[model samples]
Target chain A: MSIVVTYNKLVEFGDCDPARIVWFPNYFKWIDAASRNYFTQRGVPPWHATEREFGILGTPVVDTHAQFTNTASYGDVLSIHTRITQWRKTSFVMHYEVMRDHCSIMTCIETRVFAKHVGNTPDSSHHQIKAIPVPEFIKQLCGFSQ
Target chain B: MSIVVTYNKLVEFGDCDPARIVWFPNYFKWIDAASRNYFTQRGVPPWHATEREFGILGTPVVDTHAQFTNTASYGDVLSIHTRITQWRKTSFVMHYEVMRDHCSIMTCIETRVFAKHVGNTPDSSHHQIKAIPVPEFIKQLCGFSQ
Candidate 1:
């Protein structure tokens, strides 16, 4: 399945720095929000809810890179494109491209790995933890398994 | 004089996915916060205020890259180190390293260019805008000029 989502955002004042250009870090925040929205549109509940229900942890990002091709100013309409580039047994990768007026302005690639939630514990060694396979439903949704 | 500031953060619940580790995008957020705080400690008001007084726009990021060396869980105490790396005519760079328990967990570098903020009218263009020089106060603080 080809999963693609587009979001049009006007650079808000909070999103810009003193220079009135969109803050660099805020771009990543927008991309992350768009990624979550994409999953929500696919009929998958938010990742946190999914984790709590199934005891399936999320894959935290282990690596990330971004390149800015053009400067975006306040009120610029940014179109964000997110797509899954790799889905493995224990890890997955996503690619994002932000464009303005159909021209590419930024790109990013992120890699994440599965992890288990250990409950609150004072001792670092005794925290509850376990590694489990990707859930069948999610694997199917992600097109990794039939 | 070298300036160093440490920020204590409770990894927000929203910062983690099912993986139980800090999300990649949140790393940028944390680093950005720390960097801003560093500036605050140096007596350079927040970027927003600086912009208003000097008519000097902040630099726009041209690139960012990060490597996650270790996994950081929720409620972890993360210490971020930020230092100015390059001070150029119309741009500057910052390097950041995130640590937990004395172990380096992440590193990031960002390059930003100083530019003038033209209005958001349809006729506005980046070309028509100009590059403003770094303010004299900032230059002194950054040790670029005394």
Candidate 2:
């Protein structure tokens, strides 16, 4: 299933550089927040909660790439669109397109992995926690595949 | 000389949530750009330039920590104050504070380390490139020790 999230954003002055453009790194931050919101809105809660409940650890960024197509200033309204592109046994990927006034500002792709929660134990075996198959119930809502 | 770069920005609509708070991660992105601008203002140019011209490598983030004190919403004016906190032989630290309405909203500390640039060589030696010394000229401008 494809999930589309739209919101209007005002660029804060601190988000730009001397070149008067939104810093490249800021785009990732915006999309990350949006992704978290998207999951929460879908009743899955944050990834941190998923880890705690299932003892499955969410891997930090393994790979990330972005392409800047346009410039944004400190007061421009930006709209962000994010969708899951791929899912695997232990990993998934997401693609994001950020736009302003019908023009694409940036696009990003990110991949992440999962493992057993390594919270307190340092010598824990590196076994892959079973991937939580997309529940059929939620799949109906999200139109996602199992 | 201490150079100040001011950027005009508009808060993107996605920067705020239902509660109208600017998400936290965006603060780091702002400071990241400011720090890069700081280096450029200091004549180092972008890290990419240093890699090409001086055979110096771009530093990678080793660690980062931040404290959130206040909330900024969409369209708020935010000013970021960034400066070098410490410069060691092979590494440096930067401190950033984000402000809105003259009140601090967040503070961040980031540490990074540099190595010699090695093009297309994964195992290339970086031992030969000594740590870059802080020039006396910059010392006078920033009024800090190396």
Q: What is the per-residue lDDT of model 1 for residues B53-101, given as tens digits with 9 covering 90 to 100?
A: 7655555566787888776777777888887777777767778889877
Runs of candidate 2 exceeding 4 Å displacement? A56-59, A119-141, B1-146
Structural similarity to truth (TM-score) of each candidate: 0.71, 0.47
Candidate 1's DockQ: 0.40
Specify the highest-lDDT model's number. 1
Once fitted onto the true fold, the runs of candidate 1 whose alpha carbons sit more than 4 angstroms away are A1-3, A42-45, A73-76, A119-139, A144-146, B1-26, B37-55, B69-76, B86-90, B118-146
User: Candidate 2: which docking quality band?
Assistant: incorrect
lDDT of 2: 0.59
Candidate 2, residues B1-146: lDDT per residue as tens digits? Answer: 33344433445668654333564455656766777666666666565666677655544444455565555667677887777778665567777777776777777677655545223356632122334544344444545543
